[model samples]
Target chain A: MLNKVEAYFTKELKEKAGILVVLTLLLLVPQYSWRLFFLLLLIASLLPRDVHRGKIKLMVSLPFSKGDVFWISYAFLITIIVITQIIGGAFFNISLSGIGWDILGTLIFSSAYFGIAMISVSLGFGNFGIPFLVLIADSFFGAIGNNWEFTYNLFRSPSGLNPYRMISPIYQGNRFAAFVFAAALLITAYILFERKGTSK
Target chain B: MIVKVENLQKSFSGKFVLNGVSFDVKEGEMFALIGPNGAGKTTTLRCLYGDLTPNGGKIELFGKAFSSKSKERIAVMNEERETFRRLTGGDYVKMWSLLYPKWNDKIFSNFALHYKFDLEQRVETYSIGMKTVFYVALTVASNADVLILDEPTQHLDPLIRNEILKVISNYTLEEKKTIIISSHEIYELEEISTSFAIIKEGKVLYSDTVDDAKASHRLISRDEKASQGEVIGLVGDDTLVKTDKDVGRFPKFEEIVLGYLGGRREFIPF
Candidate 1:
């Protein structure tokens, strides 16, 4: 079972390049955009790990409870976030603390990406839901940013045409709100996707 | 091991593909679900393997009732398995093993090498017979008590076909494993099958011991068109008589076929 899980990341799924692609976009691009990173993470987490119907059934049947699958999938999404942060820190010639806001933003984005993707895809939605949910979160988070007490202080206010304005991937004091954002979008995705039948 | 299929009923729309089919398969016996196309043999096997859900009925393994967990005792090879074109043959087998709860890697992998299987070779390039062996080897290595093989010999050369049969015979006679196999290879079934079920047009025609099949039907034939024998279904231009009565000489199916085709007219055989 240990080897099986290892194999899933290594052999079964080619995840390393996906992680690398997200990192390259995050670090090298002149204008900062968390959306692309979020998008990549969404696809990595949600896509059917196995295309064959039988193989898909087999993967789901691994000695894993439904909860185990849900959380492990969550952890893999986070790993991507961590990898990106470490890489960004290296490229910026700074240590972890110097790149604090970027790390925080990535974490927030990762959780939101995973929560929504897991809910939607497990409930049988497709890759499109990744961008859709992220867009909804961006709008809703922007609404919160304008109305709330904290977002004004947490982000240093975006430079013009900045993509970060769309969502408070992180707000300083009420950081717990990130979880709320993730959970709400996830719940919505679940509700919508679950409406489809399991007859097939 | 006792496999009791209780009132299995599955249908699409109002048509019942499998209607109330039930049978008990005993341990160490070669059982074939002989049926024409669409006769529910595959459907019944699918339900037994937990791949399909019947509208009604249940399967019992040993004395316990069947459940999803009960699948650990069985390995199923689908009739037309979608072979992964990208993965190597070894990896393909390994993936199947991961799905198996009792998956023993050493035993299965060793057998692959013993068969001179190149694990590095991709499955898309494999012949249909090699692919079948790939599926079967994974199951056999799991040491599962029950093997549900559908159309096991669909595309095998004669020698490879014999190899598979030999493997099956060893498992049943030596290891005392139970098997439920469905195939059109009637001649092979006739050789190894102890108890058999005949299914046609999505229903079971009959199920009984091989000896019973031999004793229950008599082929009555004569060269003379005037001669006649009591039977349910008889076909052909020549006059042929068939009867479901015990006969002395035509005890085996080969003899029965020969008796039907090439026998001389006889006034009586007592």
Candidate 2:
């Protein structure tokens, strides 16, 4: 599994880290703030089709199980998000606690979105398709009222309500509930990847 | 047996691509898989390498059930070269070496130099032919017990093609490696394969030792043939079949394959 992680790091995450840096730089500009969520979506979408051809074949051929791949990918993603958010917060002069809560809030949403993307990709939705759809749906739900309270509040950062907290927005829901939901989705994604691997 | 696939079955969208395909490969044999396009050759290789699990079948590698450990004993160079495009040859090889416990660094370096592979260059920078050569070299370097290559020589020049075959021969002879290669290159397979299995439309048409399969079948004139063989095809009144009685000589490997694919199934002997 370490070999697989190292492989993914060298082949993919190294480039992704550069992209995250660029995205972080953009976050310093107040107007481009919406780009952060999209950046997370981009990271979530990267797992399904990292290679142009034979992605599933290559993944399954490796010694590690699909669940291992999922967990490694998730860990890498969370690490990237945390690091980038910290950098962005420093540049934007946001409080450390504010940025920490913001990272935690985004982590939950990211995991949920990643899970949905994984399930959809396993169901043949291809990379980028499901993640992009989920991002749009999240924004749409955030725009409406309490109909999609879970998704709406998740996307709506409480920090956005304050002038100083503009760069780092925390979620409004029960933090534990969000974490539990993310865990559930992650397990679902793992099961889906396993099923897809077997189905092939 | 190094690899055993028993009654394998696979389907996509309610259509069976491979149905009850069964074959066994010995510990140190060069097994060839031959078939036309969409003939389930790739599917069979995928199942062997754990890329695609068989819906109903048992696949054993190294005397154990197919699992992550089984995969460690197998190295594959699938026809799809578009993967690993992001990594340089050096990085990819380094990663592969880490994946396999018994990686032969000395052998890998020797082949790397022989193939003129630019270790520092990204795979996407190489031409398609060069990429195939690099992958073949990498798989050999893995030093796994079983090598499963799908269309290993596609997009390669004749020179590299011969070189690849030579490397396979040396790998089998010197290291006692087992190879299960799927390719349309019959002449190439003829030169190296000890045994082979021919499949058509997801069904095994024939499976036997190369020498026996060739000796058991021949192309003879309908007017001169005797009884007890399956007629494969007709060529200008000459009937091709797998016969019990020996024709004066054996047919070429290509002749036998073409016979099985295009010939009539009925046995006709004069």
Task: Write model 2 residue lDDT over A1-200, tens digit each, in one string.
Answer: 67767766665554456665565565444333365456554555467555222365666665555665678777777776777678778878889898887777778777777777777777776566666766665555444334556644665456433221212122324667657766787789888776666333
Q: Residues A135-175, candidate 1, lDDT per residue (tens digit)?
A: 56665566443555575456435542223443345332345
**Candidate 1 chain B least-lDDT 10 residues:** B232-241
List, in order, the clash count of every candidate structure. Answer: 1, 1
Best by DockQ: 2
Model 2 chain B: worst 10 consecutive residues (lDDT sum): B78-87
Give me the runs in candidate 2 sitting further than 4 Å from their true place.
A14-18, A24-36, A49-56, A59-65, A86-101, A126-129, A132-172, A197-200, B235-237, B246-248, B265-270
Error of 1 at B221 (Å): 6.2
Residue A190, model 1: Cα distance from true site in angstroms: 9.5
lDDT of 1 by residue, B50-154 (tens): 545578887888778865456657776778754554668766666656656667888777668766777898776777777788877876776788888888878
Q: Write the per-residue lDDT of candidate 2 for residues B46-94, one digit (tens) a residue.
A: 8887677678889988888877766777788877775554677887787
Interface Cα RMSD per model, in Å? 5.3, 2.8
